[model samples]
Target: GLRNYVQMFTEDPRYWRSVVTTLTYVVIAVPLQLALALVVALALKGMKRGKAFYRSAFYAPSLLGASMSIALVWRAIFNDGGTVDHLSGTGGWVNKPGWALLAVALLTVWQFGAPMVIFLAGLQQIPAELYEAAACDGASKWRQFLSVTVPMLSPVIFFNLVLQTIQAFQVFTPAFAVSAGKGGPADSTLVYTMYLYDRGFVASHMGYASAMAWVLLVVIGAVTAVLFRTSRSWVFYASEGDR
Candidate 1:
């Protein structure tokens, strides 16, 4: 059955368009989210006052982000007559394709807590002496950060990149909840996994969906492999070869 459907879905331009849509979202959302998280992590490192409070505050949204209640809240915020539209005053921004994609991106960006926390922990483990040593050598903050901070944190960054990329590729709940399962306003928000759901469950094209699932697995695996191979030149493991 999958054999039959694979041939059909592959030949269908509409199905490929759905695949491209999902890939585009993952490519944009994942990197931007991680970059923002890294910046937040850098800011929080070594702060003395209100550290616990701030960390918790930043992390709270992520913890609750995927919950049904939170998804409903997001839906309300982006609805036609919602606060975002009222603020923009454009009357129908949410219904527009560009704004709708942006709204989804914002939803993904809001869940930065996990990666931020990971980066914070990684930043903490980096020795303060490294910074001090760089300072004594007359290295500017930017230079020291480039030469030392980045190298030391490369392993952590690599880990987060891989994990988050996979998560972004598999994203479903936010799109489903925010778009109300219709993918919204002209299928602009339809992600690959959501498409898979439509095919497998809604359309009862189980075989086709299964093939798409495997294709997704292969695509993710290939991307991950590329990251790992590229990392050999960048990621500096402290325990190199001890494993």
Candidate 2:
């Protein structure tokens, strides 16, 4: 019975579509989020004024993101006549699936402060002498960033990558809240975790939902393994001291 349900849903095109949508979200969101975080962290490093306040302001959204009340607030803000649509002067855009996806993407991007804080901590640990040495050698700032900062930060980057990948794959609240549970006018916001919720709880397809969960685990594992394999080429371990 369980295997049958698992096979049934896994074979369904709609189920696959949800998986693809979620994966696409991760593909587009995670890298851009990390890039933006890294840039902000770099810029904020060594700043003498208002650092604490700035860091707290950036991280505030992360603390609010998963709360039920906060989700409700987001729902109100993205509803058909909510602040966003009103500001854009496009009341109908909320019903458009593409815009729904973009709305979810924006929410995801706005939560970048957590990763940026992590990156800031990582950047601070890097010795200034490394940058000074680069400068002495007439290395451009961009070159110094690539050759020194990136290499030194590889471990931190890898850590953030793995953590964010797992989190992004399981993103549900924003999509559910922003799209108002219909997954939007065309199901554009139907992320995999939301699909699993619908199947397990909504449809009472517990066995099938369990299968989907296992499949998600496998997919995450495979992606992480690929990242680790690729890291050998780029990830610099300080213990090796080989540069």
Candidate 3:
């Protein structure tokens, strides 16, 4: 019964590689996406005109989301001798072992609209008077962002962090399509879900696949729990302060 689980860590070197690859993808993709989204959200928060248009335009990519079509388009852009190579005069990124995972991660980072919108909403909830007070106190914009914006937005940041982290762990289509359903050129892009799919469907090892699913769930839960635990140190809650 537990043989499949045991084999995943003990017998299967590939699974270990896949786990590392998945973590690398999540660590790279999620932070970049959140950073981009937060920057956009901050810029949009200051804009006085055509904000809706810009928001819609920025958000269009998230609407495209993780579809096969989007993934295929991404693959073409990064694939060897594809559009990116034509423009940059370099070999495509999708084939290189070190660069392939980053290439796939870029696709997800490009769709930063969802978190950007959430950040914008959170920005809207923050009081402008707080900024005015910060300005009056001779706080630099950077200082204001650190003292006022981030502390106030910590809840929203934490929320988006959890959301993006969980989503990143489950990413499938981008790697699948970018590598043509093969996490190659050397399994550098072999994500957890992609490998799980191989075990479940491609190889018909249903029991092993199910075990992998359980492992994923447990990992997600454990990571989420750790986030919640550590968040107490930095995550702010005005309600708690009020009480």
Candidate 2 lDDT over residue span 1-243, tens digit each = 666867797688768878878988998889988998898888788688988898888888888877666776766777678887789877744477767676677677778888999999999999999999999999999999999999999999998998899899989998887777767667788899988998899999888789889989998899989988988888898889754
Q: Of the candidates shown, which would achieve the greatest lDDT relative to the real structure?
A: 3
The residue pairs found clashing in candidate 2 are none
Candidate 2: 10-residue stretch with minimal lDDT: 91-100
Model 1, CA-based lDDT: 0.84
- The pairs that clash in candidate 1 are none
Per-residue C-alpha lDDT of model 1 across residues 1-243, encoded as one tens digit per residue:
656777897788667767776787887888888999999888888688988888899998888987878876887888878888789777544477666666777788889999999999999998889999999999998999898888889999999999989988898888787788877767777888888999999999887888889989998999999999998888898778412
**Could you tell me every candidate's TM-score relative to the true structure?**
0.92, 0.91, 0.97
Candidate 3 pairs with clashing backbones: none
Which regions in candidate 3 have their CA more than 4 angstroms from the true location?
Answer: none
Better of 1 and 3 by lDDT: 3
Task: Tell me the tens digit of each residue's lDDT in model 3 across 1-243.
Answer: 686479666889889888999999999999999999999999999999999999999999998968999899899889878998999887899989989999999999999999999999999999999999999999999999999999999999999999999999999999999999999989999999999999999999888888889999999999999999999999988879721
Judged by TM-score, which candidate is best?
3
The best-first sequence of candidates by lDDT reads 3, 2, 1
Q: What is the lDDT of candidate 3?
A: 0.93
Cα distance off (Å), candidate 2, residue 46: 3.4
CA RMSD of each candidate after superposition: 2.2, 2.0, 1.3
